[model samples]
Target: MLQTAVLQWPGRWTKKPRAAAPPQFRDSSQPASLTVKSPKLAVTLEPVQHEDFSSLVVSVATTRDRSAFARLFEHYAPRIKSFLLRQGTDPAQAEDLAQETMMSVWRKAAMFDPAKASAGTWIFTIARNLRIDAIRKARRPEFDPEDPAFVPDAEKPADEVINADQMGCMVREAMAELPDEQALVVRMSFFEDKPHAEIAEQLRLPLGTVKSRLRLAMRRIKEHLGDRA
Candidate 1:
């Protein structure tokens, strides 16, 4: 599976470890906890060891740990696939993106600095950038050069759109501004645009409580956004 996954990667592997008598592997049993803090959002994670993939990413980086990488893929690839599907990507393409995204994780794991972002956030950013690339490749000029209505544009390239990275950074900043409980709910809301009832169920919170927190979070985000609100 690792061998198959490598082929989907955009670049060659920079590191590949030889097998050893005493294998180096991440403690899969360790409860993962990832806390992402920023100037705009202050989310507190309730998941074990921040959902376990951050350290797995670090392990893949340092030791070229295939076992750890496998765990990471098993956990996140399906979620990535679901996200792409929700974004209107074809199912087969979404499946491809899931593998490709994990391959990217393997290639870019070395750059996963926990201090800057959690493993989940880092991986999400990579998937988002890949999606952006996909979108740009599909974008064609709306106007034909031979058309009489065609006019040369002075600024903003035809393909220029809301940058996924910049928007993600802004969202993280906005999330950072929310109180812990609100931020946590906001994060879940961001996931697949999950409904509040589902989020409440996952967090074991009352549905009304979830709705109320979301309202408060939206209010705070609007305040920070001004006209963008």
Candidate 2:
């Protein structure tokens, strides 16, 4: 069954909540920014097409468009529930968590950045995190605050901190030394947090090519960081 209870506006629980006003968009004549990875590693953010799911999320974020939220709820709730069920959650819990996940989407809509992730990626990440949290909570045991072993660890020594910083700089320098194609995929997969398939689609490369580039990049980075790593 579709979980419609959390889809309604707060304090307005009903079988069918009233639809909100349609989302508004800026004039099409104006330039919009959307970040995309170019062959040269240059980035320019083109405007997302209106039919894109990212645009729907943007509508909800910018306008508090209940209609857009409803559409998102309708689309993602079932998928999230199924995802939870596959992870071994009880059906009732799955249904409830699905509703909670959508509610989180509604609340955290403003945090969604299309430049960083596709709508499905961002939404599913939330669902996955909620599931992980549920599992952890269920398995966690009570702990005493006075337990000496529970104390936080001491801060790293100054030398260790300096070494870590130097290592990070070296890693970044190594990344810069990569060929443009390899570097582009590395940034997309690591910095942008995109999956291999999404990176392949965005770059218009074969899946094998993407994997090959990543593998080559990792090998070079490892070679560069040899002793330190």
Task: Identify the candidate with maximal TM-score.
Answer: 1
Off by over 4 Å in 1: 1-48, 138-229
Over the full model, what C-alpha lDDT does candidate 2 score relative to the true structure? 0.61
Clashes of each: 12, 4
Give the clashing residue pairs of candidate 2, or none.
Answer: 33-45, 34-45, 34-46, 35-45
| Candidate 1 TM-score versus the reference | 0.45
Q: Residue 186 in candidate 1 has what lDDT?
A: 62
lDDT values, one for every candidate: 0.61, 0.61
lDDT of 2 by residue, 1-229 (tens): 2211111111111222122121122222454322232233332223323236777788899999999888888778987775555444678888988998999988999999775567777888787677757754644344666798887546865543334234444455566566656655665563322469866765567799889989999988877766333
Task: Tell me the spans in candidate 2 whose CA falls farther than 4 Å from its real position.
Answer: 1-51, 138-229
Residue 167 Cα positional deviation in candidate 2, in Å, after optimal superposition: 28
TM-scores, all candidates, are 0.45, 0.40
RMSD of each: 17.1, 17.7
